[model samples]
Target: MSPRKILGWLRAYAAHDDPLVATANLVALVVASNVPFYPVYHLLLIGRDAWPALLEAPVALIFFAIPWVSRRSGLVGRTLPPLVGVANTLFCMKILGEASGNALFLVPCVVAAAFSFRAKERWVMLPLVWLPVAVFLLSIDRMGAPLAPFTDAQFAAMLRLNAVSTGIFVGFLGMLYGRAGIESARASR
Candidate 1:
């Protein structure tokens, strides 16, 4: 799209209006999912390998917290998408190496894609949710890898979990965004 359109979207996102807040929340969810890694760091009590996930949680939490703080402070709700965009890339990389991490990490991306649609047509973003999920599945199959480690049962469970998580998140975003859109429109009048 044109820069003007992109800027318009960015302006809307930063405005503390409905969709923007919801978008921020989605970004928070993405970071929140990573929160588990912190406990795992202590649980495993490992050294360097665990550090990335360990450090990522708090940073993600801060990103998640910003929108709420900004709302109270009357600051614009900007910063979430860019943060989420970066986080998504990181999560995608993690997924490449870690099979179990895929389901949780996909949450934010799915939510963000949902919010990107006009509230009335948010369902159109459902397919975007499937994209990461499909890649994750294909990854488990080791389609490009030297070998696949998961059994059929494990793969089935992963698919089931992916489907359920995607459904729940997509539904959640749709309802949240849909309500926010209606409320915003009403407030404007």
Candidate 2:
């Protein structure tokens, strides 16, 4: 194919409006977010301890592949949303387990799920917001001072606050998006 045709095809692929695309984009954002830290980690020679950050790349690739697989497997509408949600939730838990302060990353994951999945699929996003809190609560003793750079109480409070705030923020955005979508549908009709 010509370069122009390839570009046009790529644009159409990206604009396909599939939930898998949204999920993949969110995962891509997560991968991008890690880019800046890599240089610092390497400069500080802490890259060896930063192995978890390396996992995001492959995860992002898998997320990017999901849309194509779903397109062929007929899983886009039925299975993909929940699968993405669960994967995101697990990813959040892994990050939280590795570093407590990184809990903030869960918010965007939840928000992405909100934007990707329909209202009826909102349940998928809920655990993405809450699982980190549960992990934090369960691992409180091991998360203080040397390991976490915060007191146990402070870390707990921060984790709880982040989870609650993210939930509310994503919920509000979801409602706003839902209303806008409804209005757009009505206008179209």
Q: Pick the candidate with the highest lDDT.
A: 1
TM-score of every candidate: 0.46, 0.47
lDDT of each: 0.50, 0.46
Error of 2 at 2 (Å): 11
Writing each residue's lDDT as its tens digit, candidate 1 over 16-71 gives 65555655554455445545554364235433333444434455556556556657
Predict model 1's lDDT versus the native: 0.50
State the lDDT of candidate 2 residue by residue for 1-189, as single tens digits: 999997676445433344344334333433434434433442243324434444544544544555455455432422443354445445534543433344454455445544544555657555544554565456545543332133455445435644664566466556645654565457558
Model 2: residues with Cα > 4 Å off, grouped in runs: 1-9, 17-52, 70-100, 120-188
The TM-score obtained by model 1 is: 0.46
